[model samples]
Target: MIKGDSLMFRGRLRGTALWGGSLLLAGCMLNIFLQAASLGMKFGAVADWVARYPALYLAGSLFLFFLLLLFAALVPGGYPGPLLAVAVVVLLGTADNRKLATTGEPLFPWDLMLLKNAGEMRHITRGMLSPLWIAIAAALIVLLLYGMRKLPKVRMRLTWRLLLGGVSAALAGGFLFVVGSGSSLASSLHYENLYWNQKVNYTQNGFLFAFAGNLHQNVMEKPDGYSREAILRIAAKYGGNGSEAANPAPTGGTQAEQDAKMPDILFMMDEAFFDPTRLPGYSFSADPLVFIHGAAKSSPSGYLLSPEFGGNTANVEFEALTGLSMYFLNDGSVPFQQRLVKMSSLPSIVSILKQRGYAALALHPFDDTFYNRNRVYPMLGFDRFTSEKDLPKAARMTPGGYISDLAAVQEAVRELRASKGPAFLHLVTMQNHFPFTSGKNGPNTIAVSGGKEAYRKELETYAQDTKLTDEALAELAKELKELPRRTVAVFWGDHLPALSAGIYAEAGWDAKPRLKHETKLMLLANFDIGAEGTGTLSPAFLGPEVFRRAGLAEPPFYQLLDRVKAELPGLSGSVRIGSGGNEIRKLTPEQEALLSDYRLVEYDLLEGKQYSAKLMF
Candidate 1:
C-alpha cells in the first residue's frame, strides 16, 4: 500500500536513517569543540570564565548538533545500513576544512605542541570530540559494511533515485568544511568571533566575550597588599581623585588684576608639521610654525611622544582633557568608547573652574561633534562646546577642508570675552588635518618657502593658514597683554600632518624619523602659563605640567601618575611597548602593585569607588 517493494524497502530506509543521524549529530559537536580550541590556541588563550555562559554558548552548541541530526535521520535508508556510507566520509572531510581556516595561527590542531596549559586544556576538549567523532564514523562504517554484505542483493532491488540522494547528502557535508570556516565562515566573524576579534579588533579591552564573569579571571585578582588597595590609596598618593577632592576649592586661587583675570587660552594643532629629512642644516628657512614660536614667550618645546601613528586624534584629545594617558591600559581599545573613562580629566578641570565661578567653553571650528565630543565634552565638564555648525566655516589649509585654526581662535576669544567671571575656553583648530593636497593645483601656494617643492603648493596654503592663526594670536596676545584680568593662553599642535607613504618613499628616505617628526608638539604661551617653557612631552606629562603651570591643584591621580612617570619619564611610556629604555607590555606584579598603590591613593583623594583611573598598568 505504501509503494513498490513494500517490506524490504521500508527496512532498508529505516536502517539508513539511524546510521546517518548518528554521524550528523557528531559533526555538530565537532564544530563547537573545534572553534573553542582554535580561539584559545591562536590569539593567546581566552580566560575560562566564558564556559559559564550556558544560555548563549550551550544553546548554540545543542542547536548545531540537532541540525546535523535532523538532516541524517531523514535519510532514505534510516539506520545501520547503506545510509551510513554517506555519513562517515562526510565527517572526515569536514574536520579537514576546520584545519584549513585556522592556519597561520597557532591553533590548527597540529600546533598543539606550542600551546600553553590553557591552550592545552582547550586542545584536549577539542580532542575529546575526535574519538567521539571517530567512534560515530566507526559505527557508520560498520553499518555500511553490514549493508554492503547485503548490497549486491539489495542494490538490484532499490531505485536509482535513492542512491543519488545518499551521494548528494554526503557531498554537501564535505562542501561545508571547505567553504564554511575561517574568516569566511560568517559575516559576523568580524565583531563576533572571540579569536579574530582579539587579533584584529580595536575595541573593548580586547575581546569582550573572552570574559566569563570571574571564572576566566586569570593571574591573581589581589596578589599582594599593594593591589588590595587599588583605587583609594594609590590614586591619592599618585595624583588621583582623592587628591582631586582634597585640593583646595577651585575658587580659592588668588585673583589676578582686571587685565589678567580672564585672559584667553589658545591651543593650536599644526597640521602635517613634521620634517624627518632636513636636507642637512638647510635652516629649512621660513616660519613653518615660526610666528607662534618666535612671538610667543617660548620656553623649551620639543616633540611629544604620542600614541597614534597614521591617525588617532582622540588619543591626543584624551591626554589633553583627562591628563590620564591612554597608554596605561593595554593598547587595543579606547576607554571612553567603553564604560571605562574614570580619570580626573578635562571635564574635571572645566568643572573646577565652573565650580570656582568661571565660564567654561570649548571651541573647535571643525565638527565639534565629529568624535562624539559633544558627549565627551559634557562628561569632561565643559559648559559649552562650539563646533563648525555653531561657528562660521572658513577654507582649511588642507584638502580636508577644516576651518582655519586662526578662525577658531579669534571666534573663541571674542565669544568668551563677552561673558562674565573667570573662564576656561578650549579651542582646537583645523586646516592642518590631512590630505595635504590643498592649493596643489592653485597658484596661491607658489610663493611658500622651506619644506619640499613637491609639497610646494600644499605648504603654501598651510602656511597661509598658519599665518592666519599666528596673526590672530598676535592680535589677541597684544590685546590681553594689557587686559584687566591676568589671562593664560596655551597653543600647541594636536598632531602634525602626515603625507602619504608614497611621498616619503619618493623623497629617498627609507629610514626617516617618521615617528619623531610626526609627533612634535608646538607650545606657545602668554601670561603666567607661558613661562612653563616649550619643552617636549609625552602627553602623559602634559596634564601634570599644564596643571602645575596653571597653579591649579593636581587631579586625584597626580601622585600615582608622578610615580609612574618617574619610571617611564614620558607620556608614551604608558602606551608604548618601550618605556624609560625598558621593554614591558604586560605589567609585572611589582609594577601593578606600585600602580594599585597609586589607585588606592587616588580613591582616598576622590572619596569614591568609580573614581578609579579607567585602566592602569
Candidate 2:
C-alpha cells in the first residue's frame, strides 16, 4: 500500500488535479460570462434556442471549453489565459451572429429593447441565466474539493521530487505572466473596461489587441489609421482659439451681445463621403454631392483622420461636438458615450447661442439611443433631441428609423419658429445612407422618393431627398432671410455613403485600396462663412472658420485653425500640394504639444470612467 512508486504517483496526481481544476473553473466562468454577455447583447438574441435543451447544451459547451484550457495549461510555453479569453469572445460573438442569421432574427448591439420582433432573451450576461454555467461551476467545485482532500495526505509523504515539482510550477507561472504581458495578447484581457468598447469593436483584433481597426474602424486594424502627428499637435485637449476655450469672438464681442446681430446656425454632414483627392471618383452613376458642392464654401477639409470611413457616425459626431478627432487615442474607448461624464466638449455652441437668446435643438430620425445619444445630447447642452420614436408611426418605416431628411427639416423649422430665442438647429439626415438603391423599407413620404429595396433603396431615396433638402435649404433661407438678424447655415457630410464593396472594387479600382475607408466632407450654405467666400473643406477648421465667417465670437482654438490654414495655404485646394510638405506636416511645437494634452486628457477620462454632464460636444 505504501510502495515508493505508488506514493510518488499519488502525490504528482494531487498537484496536477489542483491546478487543473483551478484552470477549469476560470475557463468556464470566463466562457459563460463572455457567451452570456454576447447573447445578452442585441446581436446574440436570436441564439436563445441553445438553452432549450439545458443538459445537452451544458455538456457540449463545457467539453469544448475545458478541452482548450487543458491543452493550454499542458503546453510547455503557451498563451493560455489571454488567448482563451479572446477565443471565447470571438466564439460567442460568432455564435450569436450565426444564430441570428439562421433564425432570421435581427441582431445588433442596440436592438435589445427597441426591437419589436418576436421572441425574448433567454440568457443574461450573468451566469444565472445559463444552466451550462451552473453545471460547469458545480463540476469544477467538486473536482477542486476532491483534489484538496488528497493534498494534505500527499504533503505527509513529501519528498525531494515533490519539492522540485512545486518549484518548477512556480517558475513556470512567473514566466507565463511575463511573456503574456509583453505581447499584444494581454491587451484584450480586460477589454470590457474600455470607455468606448460598447460600440467600438475589438471583436476582430487579429489574435491580439494590436489591431486598432475595431476602434478606428480602420480597415483590418492597421497602425496607419492613427496619425501620430495629429495626436502630438494639440496636447490631447481642445486649445487655443477653438470653441472649447471661452475666447471672446476670434474678432471680438461677448456671445450675449452678438445675439441680435449673429446668424442662426444650421448644420448637416453627409455619411462616408471621403475626399475625391484622397479617393478619386473614376466612375459613378452620379456625382451628386460634387454637384451640390458647386455653390457651397469650398476648402481643403482638415485631416479628419477618422476612425471609421464607411460607417460609425458617432466618431464624426464626437469630433464635431468636441472639435477634436478621436483618431489619436485608443480607438477601443469612446469618451462621448459612457465615459462622457464630466468630459469637456467644445463649450456647447448651442448653450452659448441659447445664452445669447438663441434656441438650440437637435434633429435625428434614428433611435436617439443608438450612440447612447439620449444620454449624450443633454450633455452636449441641447435643449431637445428629435428622435425617430418622436416621429409619427408613418415615419418609422425605414430601417434605422430613417424617416426623411425633409421631415427632420420640417420639425427643425417648426421648433425654431416657436422657440423663445434665436435658433441653433443641428439636423442629421438618414434616408441617403448606404446601399444607395431604393425600397419599401425606405421613407415612403418623400419630397423626392426612390422606389427600390434594402439598404440601397434607402440611399436612392436619400439622394432624391437631397434635392429636396437643397430646395428646403433655399426655402429656409428665404424664410430666415428676412429674420430680425442674419441667419448662418452649415451643412457637411458626416462621412461618405457606403457602396457595395464589390461594386467599389469593380469600378476600375484596387478593389481593396485604403480609399474604401475615406470620405469627403461638404460644407454648404447660402451665406458666406469664409471671409473671401474662399476656404477649403476640412473638419478641423469648420467650427472656427464658420464661427469667424459668421462674425460670431470665435474660440482660441478657432484662431489656431486659421493659423494652420495660413501655414498650409494649399491645404484647401488639394490632398497634395506642389511638394509633400503640407499643413499637417508643418505643425508648430505648441500645436504638437496640444495634441499630447488632448491624448492625455482622453486617456485619463477613458481610463477612469468618471462621466460628467458638463462636458458637451
Candidate 3:
C-alpha cells in the first residue's frame, strides 16, 4: 500500500509540472506572434529587438503571460482561456499593423471608439478583409477550439480559482496604472512615450506598453493662470465687447446697407485634396488642379497647415468652424467624439452667423451619423443639416460608391437658392476618400510614374478624383459669378490622402512634418475683395482671416486669433510657422506671451466656465 501511494503521488507531481511547462510555452508563443505582427512580420527585426533589449522583451512576455493566467483562472477549461487570450492578441496585433500601413498612424486606445461606427467604415476598409483572410481566421478559430477540447484539464476548487483571478487582475491593473500615469517606474524600465509621433513610439516601445500609455490622455487641461479675470484682461487687450473694429464698415454705409453687403458665405471643405505634383519623383500627364491653380493666382490663396495627415476630417472642420486649435487638445483625442458630445452648446462661426441673420446650413453627402455629426451639428447652431438620406436618389449616385463633389456642390447651390437671405453654407465633400483603388472611377486620365505599380495606381486614381473636384469648383465659380447677390467662398483641403508611406519616402515628402501636413487653400469671391494672400496659416486662423477678407465683423475671440496670427501664422501640435512663412524653431518672448494668451483663451472656452464666453463670443 505504501509503494502504490508513492507512485500515485509522483504521477500527480509530474502532471503539475507538465501543465506549468505548457503554460510557459504558450506564453512565449503568444509574445512571439504579437511582436511579429507589430513589426509587420519582420523576423530579423524581431531578433534584433530581442538581442538589443532582452530584459524588456522578457518583461513584455511575462506581462502577456500574466494576462493569459487571468483568463485561465476565470475559465473552467484549462486550454480555452489561453486560446481566447491568444485570439484577442492576434486580432489586435494584425489590426495595428494594417492601420499603421494604410493610414500612416498607429492604433491608439481612443481608436476603440471607432468600433461604434464599424458599419460606416466599410468604405475605408473595403478590401481589408478578403475571403482568404476570413477563411484563415475561421480555420484558426476552429483549430484552437478543437485543440482546447483535446488538452487535459486541471481540476481546482472554485475558491482557489477566484483567488488566482483576483491576484492576476490586481497585477495587470497595477501595471497599467503605473504605465498610464507616466510614472518614473515606467521610465526606469525604458518605456518611452512619444505623443507627437505614435508610430515610432509603438515601434521603439512594445505595442502593449505604448498603447497603455495613452489611456490617461487629458483631453484639455486648464492652462496656467487661467481665470475669469485673466480672460477679461485678454479680451480687453483685443477689444472689450467683441466689436467689429477689425472689419471696418465701408464708408457712408448704414447698418442695413452693411448687413445687405455681407455676402453669402460658403465653406467648401474638400476631402483629401492636395497637389500631388509637389511630391518629387512623380510626373503627371497634365496639371490635375488646373482650375484651382488658376484661381489661386488671382485670389487669396496659400497652403493651409492641417493638423491631421491621413484621416480625422472632423477635427479640421472643428478648427475652421470654432477657431480652436487642435494643438491645445491631447494628441489622438477626437473633440467631436470625446468633448463635443458632453456640451449642450458651444460658440462657433455658425452660431455667430446665425445671430447676424445668416441662415446656417451644414451639408455632407454621406451618412449623418459619421463622427456623430448628426447630433453635434445642432449644438454648433446649424439651422439645417443635410445628409445623403435627405438627397434624391439621382443626386446621390456616383461611380465609386461615394457622392461626387459635383453632386454635393449642386445640392449646396440648391440650398443657397432656397434660403430667404444671406446664408452660411458649410459643405463637406466626400469624393476623394480613402482606399483609392485603381479604376474606381473608370479609366484614370492622370498617369503617375515613379512609385511601385500599386502606389502608382493609387496616385493616378487620387489625382483623377481631385481633377473632378477641380472641374466641379470651376462650374461652381461660373454659377456664382452669374448670381445677382454677391458671395464669398472659402475652399480648402481637409487633409492629405492616405497613400503608402513608401511613396512619401521615395518622393522626399516625409523630410518635414510641414510638407506632410500642408494642403491647398483658396479664398474666392464673386465680387472683388483685396488681393491679400493668406500665406501659411492654420485652420484655426482661417475663420478670422475669412472675416477680415470679406469685411465682416470679427468677434473678440477672433480678434485674439488675429493677434496670435500676427506672431505665429501657422501652429500645429508638431510644427509652428512664423508670420514670414518660415518654420520657427524657437519662440521669441513676445511670441511666447501671445501663445500663452491663446492657450488660456482656448482653455477657458473649451473646458473652463462661461466666464470668457460672454466677453469673447
Give the top-scoring candidate (TM-score). Answer: 3
* TM-score leaderboard ranking: 3, 2, 1
- What TM-score goes with each of the models? 0.55, 0.55, 0.88
Error of 1 at 517 (Å): 6.6
lDDT score, candidate 2, position 319: 59
Q: Model 1: per-residue lDDT, tens digit, 1-617?
A: 66667986888777556544554565444434434443543422332422433333433334344434434344433333324534532443344323322221121121221233343234222323446556866786686677645543322224443454466456554333322342243233222333322333212212122221111211112223434354444444544443333454434345644324334444444444443323231232355455456653454355565654434456576666555554443333343433223344433455545544567788877554445566678777777888777865555444434566556656766766676666777776655554444553132422554445655555555454555555666666665655555566655555544444444444554364334333545444445455434334555556555555656655445545555655554445223332444434677676666555643433332323444533221
The C-alpha lDDT values of all candidates are: 0.46, 0.45, 0.81
Model 3, TM vs. native: 0.88
Model 1 bad stretches (over 4 Å) = 1-228, 235-244, 250-266, 269-285, 340-347, 393-400, 438-476, 504-514, 522-525, 528-534, 573-608, 611-617
Query: Model 2: per-residue lDDT, tens digit, 453-494?
Result: 332334445445454455544555455545554556665556
What lDDT score goes with residue 230 in model 3? 90
